[model samples]
Target: MAISDFFCPQTTSIVAKRERRKEARPGELLNAALDLFVEKGFAATRVEEVAARAGVSKGTLFLYFPSKEELFKAVVRENISGRFKAWNDEFEAFEGNTCEMLCYCMNSWWERVGATKTSGITKLMMSEAKNFPELAAFYQHEVVLPGQSLIRRILQRGMDRGEFRPLDLDYAVYSVVAPMIFLMLSRHAVGACVPAHVELDPKKYIATQLSTILYGLRLSPGDMEPSQEIPQA
Candidate 1:
């Protein structure tokens, strides 16, 4: 056998290429796991299936994630954690009129998540939190709280500037996001459960909801705009 053919066989290049791709394998595995978990859920998704989808063997999968639960945790950490960090960082740097900012943020929120695959996470959490308490807790601490905090900061800023009414910050925060949360759940959970509770065009619904919310939250009209004088004797 020629030395070149003996030492550097065809399979050798493929093996070397795969070895060079080791750094990306974990991310690939996590992405595959996310898709499967989103589709079949955590309880139903198998490690072997995730491995197959990721183009890795089960043994290789275990080398990175010892168990399915650990893999799921990695999925959460990789996806939600990074997204939340970037979102919070952007929110922190935002500067504008509170009403405009509120609308902008709400619209951005819906586009980024409410109508996307990420919305399924709300369903997953609700369904699986009882069984996966540790993962649920981590998700709450890392994702939910940060999200709530961002909402609270926006609402608090509006209130602080006399743009919105002074309201209970805690519950107000939740109320502000309640519609989006409900949409997320309803879309993923009971999207086609026979008779619908309410059919809506999301854009119109958001406009109406935000209008109502803004009306309620804004400073009283008398305080906002000067009252016209009554000239009648």
Candidate 2:
């Protein structure tokens, strides 16, 4: 037992409880911030609201995050960018054909991120990035670049194995990514307004997208024409 416990058991218990709460505050704050940021976009979410949701004072939040921008950075790193290394490692260790790998990649992303509140980050960025250029630049550097690089590596792997046809890596990566962007936008931005009759099943949508992309990418020796840049109007 602690010395305080010896002196007064109840006093020690309260102190221990406070210490535990202190330790948990940062995580609680991040969770609260994420929920609010998703529900009310970044500009509308005040630091005070985050602290209140976390059951702390506004001053206490500053003690940990210093600024709203800093808190947001921490939240993005905690929820999204931090996982890139493990994902990249998974790519490196994968033994399947590139088609299987791409399928796994898309489905895994839906499970891990696309179907979660974390997906709101992309919608949030699309809506507010113009006003917060610094944060936008930070996100581009931390999330966008790494994500594109990972996709490029996947496409390159297919090409190297001769399973995928030769294509411009820069443009082809976006071709692979565009469907996912549409999915994110649909879920976070436009889903509420979309009619229920035609609502998409994300799993089926991804399967169809994967089938389409893989068909386009599969090697067909002497049958495919080289891609040409579109002429400017």
Candidate 3:
């Protein structure tokens, strides 16, 4: 074998590795940015910190993100907003009844977002959005509105199928969202201050909330199914 052939393959391998690394830079930066944004909040996190965490220079970060605001937007898109299309598709393809679908939706959200560090994005936005109006609007447009729409669709599915009674959807969506926001807040912020003796089980909490939403707090003698009975404290 010619010595040139061995050397040529090695050279090609090195070039391929470099190209792969270049392709991965944007994702690395986004992951690093998410970590910092979640830990430090948006205002406190610096662009240089994100680049350094990603093992890249500030200029390289700019090559992809252009500006800090844009970088943050990209991070939000990658972590949160990007999943909406797949979620919507899941809704379309779901085989379960609306009640089961609602349960699946909330559980899926917990698995995907609540159980992950990505949930901190919600905490970050809640704390910092008041100070950054532009980013707040962007978040509203990108995450909040779509999220509400998705929830409305879920509720509407229930109503249309007769699983749920007619509701004032404008207000009902907020009711559905309230517990989720509490869970996020509890996970990211409020849970920190919670007493160590008190165990906060998100899965159990979600189950309880779903039951309340579906069955209501009021129990008529005839209304309670044995399976749907709320366990007494």
Candidate 4:
């Protein structure tokens, strides 16, 4: 019998099912690998363990990711890229005055950080980066630089519009963003050693910090009454 005539509908259906199973294999393996990497440090986590987590044989995991390093990089990239896109979208939607825009951006970023477990992962990566240059480079190139650049552009626009005081754009960007970064790093990465100096409310912290940078905390013109003249003693 010819090949077409010999193949029954049941045989064709079985082949189609096998093909779908094969196609789904890689994604399943990647997800399993990511979960393991996040739960266990990348250097300590073994490929065999990842395969076991995915319910695939060791050889099958290699077919999807050639090396453990590649798999770890993929996990970080996949986790953070969606977040960057969301931030960009929120920034683009900002239509308020410059002060309002600054406040909005800070609030949006804080909300995002609170929403994702990625912050914990980020803390892990930073602590481990000294040992893994490749992963560190990937994060710097893919995440940090792009975010800073976007912020710098916003600051530049605000400066041009006279909504913000004229200052070095890079310096301005750093001034606004550095505190938030430090707060996370100090609390999560380094571990706070000091006793509670202030309440740890993220919203209030962000508002107070941003206001200090954007508008000095010193009493505004209307808030202070003119001082009565006094002769020097």
Candidate 5:
């Protein structure tokens, strides 16, 4: 409820638009926070700097986010939560074969979460989890569990259809995610000074990992034959 909205009925529409813009400031601030958090680890990012990047006063930032951890949680929610919901929504209506669904889901996952700078958050969590247990727990409940559940559902679907062998769902989920997790860690833990020959490339790594995963999951001879190569990652 902005002051302008209370003052006049005649200009109510204009005031409503102004209020909406004011409401949008928090999201803009969160986006700024995300960029800074990615560039500098969470512990190093200052609230004043986030406020400056967001074009708002430090007071305004506090009005929206009471603490730095709260702001970080907001950034995490913005980057992962909404996308997860949308991913599940799209997945619910997906009509592909189980194997195709696996590839489709991974490709979507990589594009939506992996390709973006936001993906760095996963590595951040891994590094900070011991020191920031509550934050790690929040992420576990909010993002990781939901994501693993989605994979579990897909694996169950394959088993039900006899497209895949019975699998230990927990281990299978780790198998699916390990490569992407490794890549995220490698980007941070493996410094930029590494030789070109030793540097890891995500496209190839993801491709090889997926191919191997599908190979083991396939129940039929033709199922193992890839319809298409992973496009020369």
Candidate 6:
């Protein structure tokens, strides 16, 4: 009998079980390594300890990740790239005003990062970038560039629709994005003690930032006005 025609329930079940195990194994190793790295700092965490935490042999960990550096890269890819992919998927079907859509996407992206356990890990990666050129390059290429591209596309659409003024697209895109990056990084310096009254709410903060940019770029005088009726005092 042909191999394709010989499909049996027992064989299929064994193949499915093996596939699940293979997928789970790498994820378990990565999570264990990430936890140790976050807890002990990357330089202090050893591979053997990661293997022990993952309940796998050191050889098996090495089989999946050839080196410590490679494993760290995997951790970054898992935490950072995966988040961006989720954001991209969430907004893939988005159709709205260019400025509003950009703000929505940016706000959602920040919210997701804020919710993740790996936010501290991302902070570590940013702080250690000077010492880790490969990681820095990977982060810029994979995360920053894609984000910039999205921003640029939004600005291009606005400019095309004459919704925004004819400014240098590159500069306008950067202006919109750079402030958000600064605000996100500012959290590390500001600490959790930001007073409740003054604490930066991500959604409102993003809306204000995007509004400021739109104010500068918006083409129509009426577009600058609030879109709601004010109650008569």
Predicted structure with the largest TM-score when compared to the true one: 2
In the predicted model 5, the residue pairs found to clash are none
Each candidate's root-mean-square deviation in Å? 5.5, 3.3, 5.5, 6.3, 7.5, 8.0
Model 3 residue 192 CA deviation in Å:
5.7
Which model scores highest in lDDT?
Answer: 2
The lDDT values for all models are 0.81, 0.92, 0.88, 0.71, 0.84, 0.74
Candidate 2 TM-score to native: 0.91
My TM-score estimates for the predictions, one after another, are 0.82, 0.91, 0.89, 0.70, 0.81, 0.71
lDDT of 3 by residue, 102-139 (tens): 88999999999888999999988888999999999999
- Candidate 5 lDDT over 45-101, as tens digits, reads 899999999888999999999999999999988889767778888778989989889
Better of 3 and 5 by lDDT: 3
A best-first ranking of the candidates according to their lDDT comes to 2, 3, 5, 1, 6, 4
lDDT score, candidate 4: 0.71
Model 3's lDDT to the true fold?
A: 0.88
Model 5 misplaced regions, further than 4 Å: 1-21, 187-201, 221-233
1-233 per-residue lDDT for model 4 (tens digits): 77777678779899999899889887777778767765676788899998888888999888878898888767666666557777777678877776787777777766766334555556667678999998888888887787787788678767677566555665667887687676565455343622456546677778889878877422233443325444599
Instruction: Provide the lDDT at 183 for model 5.
Output: 70
Q: Which lDDT tens digits does candidate 2 get at residues 121-196? A: 9989988999999999999988999999999999999989999988789899998788998888888766453554
Indicate whether candidate 2 or candidate 3 has the larger lDDT. Answer: 2
Candidate 6: residue 48 Cα off by (Å): 3.4
The digit string of per-residue lDDT tens for model 6 on 1-233 reads: 77766778678899999888778989999999888877676667799999999988999999999988889889878877666666656555667877777777677667766444455565566667788788778878877777777777777878887777666766777897676665655564455435435677767777788788778777886543445555799
Quote the positional error of residue 182 for candidate 3 in Å. 1.0
lDDT, residue 153, model 1? 83
Better of 1 and 4 by TM-score: 1
Between candidates 3 and 4, the lDDT winner = 3
Residue 133 CA error for candidate 3 (Å)?
0.7
**On lDDT, who's better, 2 or 5?**
2
